[model samples]
Target: MKIAFIGTGLMGYPMAKNLLEKNLELNVFSRTIEKAKPLEKFAAKISNSLSEAVKGVDVVITMLTDDDAVEKVLSDQDFQENLKKGSTIVDMSSIKPKIAIKYGKLLKDQGINFLDAPVSGGTIGAEQATLAIMVGGDQKVFDQIKDVLKVMGNPTLVGPIGSGQVSKLANQIIVGITIGAVAEAITLCEKAGVDGNKFIKALAGGFADGKILQNHGKRMIDKDFSPKGKVSTHLKDMNNILECAGDLNTQLPISNLIKDMFKSLVENGNDNDDHSALYKEIERRNKN
Candidate 1:
C-alpha cells in the first residue's frame, strides 16, 4: 500500500523511515524540503507540496507538532479532494480529543477514515519502532491497518472516534507528573549528598523505579538539557490537560502543580530544553 507521510520532523522522520524499510511505497512531505532529503535513501518519492505528497496515496499519516498544523494540511482544498474515499488519515500528533472527533466526523462525511492515533515513547521509541500507539477509530478499520500501525509501534485500539486522543491526554498527565516527581526526587537526593546514580540502582526494583526515572533520571544527574522532548511541548500538553479537565468539571491538583513548575521553567527561558531540565530549575531556585 502507498502511504503519504507529512511533517517529517524529529519523530516523523524515523517513523517514515521504518515504513520505507518495510518496503512499503512511501511519499514524504515536509515544510522545509531539506528535512525530507534524509529519507530519500529509502527510495520514497518526496514532495514539497502537500497536494503532491498525498495525491493517489492510500494512507496519509501526520505526525505534526499540533492541531493547527494538522488543520492547515487537511484544509488544503487540493489535499482534501485528492484523498480518496476509503483511505485513512492516521494522526499521531497529541491533540485535543474534541478536535480529533470534529476532524474525524468531517473526514467520515467525505468517505475518508480518520483515526486519532496519538503515540507515547519519545524520539528513541520512534527510532526503535517500540512506541506505544493508542488508536481511536472503527474496530474494523483498525484491524485492517494493524500491521501498518505495527510498523511504527505497538498500537492498541483504545475506543471509537476520539478515544485515542483522550488516552493520549491521560498519558501526558502521567508523564508530566512522573517527570516532575523524578526531577524533585533527584534534586532532593543531590541536596542530601547521596549519589544519585546509586539511588537509582538501589531503587531499581522498588516502587521508585520507572521508565521516567531510568531515562530522564540519568539526564538529571548529568545535567543534560538536550531536547528529547522539549519543555514547550510539555507546556502545550499541560495546557490541553487543564482545558480538558475544565470541560469535564474535574480537578487535577498534581497536574496543576506540574504545570506551574513547567511555567516557571519556561518563564525563566528554558523552553527549548528537555523537560528533565526541571531539575536544574529546582536547583536554581534552591540556590537563590
Candidate 2:
C-alpha cells in the first residue's frame, strides 16, 4: 500500500526506513526537511508539502511529539484540503484520548478514517521494530492495516477510537511511577553506602525486576540521562493522564506526585533529558 510518513525525528526516522525496506511506496515529510533527507537514500520520496506527502496515499502516519504538534500538522491546509476521501490517518503521536476521539469523529465526517494508535518501546523499539502499538479505531480498518502495522511493531486493537491513547496514558503512569521507585530506591541505597549498580543485579529476577529496572535502572546508575523519552514529554503524558482522570472523577495521587517531580525537572532545565533523569530531582530532594 502507498504510505505517507510524517515527523521524522528520532523514532520516525527508523520507522520510515522499516516501511521502505518492506518495499512500500513511501512518501515522507518533516517540518525540518533535513530530518527527512536521510529517508531519501532508502528509496523513500521526500515531499516538500504535507499535502504532497499525503495526497493519494493509502495510509498517512504521524509520529509527532504531542497534542499541539499533532494538531498543528494535521490542521494544515495541505492536510485538510488535499487528503483524498477514504484514506486513513494513523496518529502515532501521544495525545489525549478525548482529543483523539474528537478528531476521529471529525475525520469520519469528512469521509476519512482516523486511528488513535499510540505506541511504547522508545527509540530502541522503533529501530528494532518491536514496539508495542495500541490502536483504537474501526476493527475493519485495523484489520486492513494490520500487516502494515506489524512492520513497525506488535499492533493490538484496544477498543474503539481513543482507547489507544487511554492505554498509553496508563502505560505512562506505570512507567513514571516505576522510574520514581527505581530512582528513589537507588538514591536511598547509595546514601546508605550500597553500590547502586550491584543493587540492580541483586534485585534481578525478583518481583522488583522488570524492563525498567534493567534499562532505565542501568541508565540511572551510569548517569546516562540521554533522551529515550524526555522528562518533559513524560510530564506531558502525565498531565494528559491527570486530565483524563479528572474527566472520569478519578483520583491519581501518585500520578500527581510524579507529575510534579517531572515538572520540577523541566523547570530546572532538564526538560530534554531522559525521563529517567527524574533521578536528578530525587537526588536534589535528598540533599535538601
Candidate 3:
C-alpha cells in the first residue's frame, strides 16, 4: 500500500524508516527537504510540499509535534481534495483527545478514515521499532491497517475516536510521575553521598526498575541533557493533561505536581534539554 509520512524529526525519522524498510511504497514530507533526504535512498519519494506528499496516497501518517501542525496539514485545501476517499490518516502525535475527536469527525465527513494513534517509548523505541502505539479509531479501519501499524510499532486499539489521545495523556501522567520520582530518589541519593549508579544497580530488579529509571536514570547519572525527549514536549503533554482534567472536572494532584516540576525545569534553562534533566532541577533545589 502507498503511504505518506509527514514530519521527519527524531521519532518521525526512524518511524518512517521502519515503514520504508517494511517494503511499503513510501513518500516523505517534512518542513525541511534535507530531513527527508536520508529516506530517499530507501526508495522513498521525497515531497517538497504537503500536497505532493499526501496526494494520491492510500494512507497518510502524521507524527508532528502538536495539534496545530496536524491541523494545518490536514486542513490544507490541496490535502483535503487530493487525499482519496477511503484512505486513512493516522496521527501519532500526542495532542488533546477532544481535538482528535473533532478531526476524526471532520475527516469522516470527507469519507476519510482518521485514527488517533499516539505513541510512547521515546526515540530509542522508535528507532528500534518497539514503540507502544495507543490507537483510537474504527475497529474495521484499524484492522485494515494493522499490518502497517505493526511495521512501525506494537499498535493497540484503545477505543473509538479520541481514546488514543486519552490513553496518551494517561501515559504522559505516568511518565511524569515516574520521572519525577526517579529525579527525587536520585537527588536524595546524591545528598546522602550514595553512589547513584550503585543505587540504581541495587534497585535494578525491584519494583523501581521501570523504563524511566532504567533509561532516564543512566542519562541523569551521566548528566547528559541531550534531547531524547525534550522538556518542552513533556510540558506540552502536561498542559494537555491539565486541560483534559479541567474539561472532565477531575482532580489530579500528582499530575499537577509533576507539571509544576516540569515548569521549574523549563524555567531553569532545561526547556530544550531532555526531560530527564528534571534530576538537575531537583539537585539544584537540594543545594538551595
**Mind sharing the TM-score for model 2?**
0.98
- All candidates' TM-scores? 0.98, 0.98, 0.98
Q: Give the clashing pairs for model 2.
A: none
Ranking by lDDT: 2, 3, 1
User: lDDT, candidate 3, residue 250?
Assistant: 97
Tens-place lDDT per residue, model 3, 106-206, is 99998999999999999999999999999999999999989998987899998999999999999999998898889888878877899999999999889
lDDT agreement with native, every candidate: 0.91, 0.93, 0.91
Q: Write the per-residue lDDT of candidate 2 for residues 50-119, one digit (tens) a residue.
A: 9899988889999998899998887787687788899999999999998899889988988999999999
* Model 1: lDDT to the true structure: 0.91
Candidate number achieving the greatest lDDT relative to the actual structure:
2
Once superposed on the true structure, which residue ranges of model 2 sit more than 4 Å away at CA? none
Candidate 3 lDDT (Cα, whole model)? Answer: 0.91
Q: Among all windows of ten consecutive residues in candidate 3, which has the lowest summed lDDT?
A: 278-287
The C-alpha stretches of model 3 lying farther than 4 A from their native spots are none
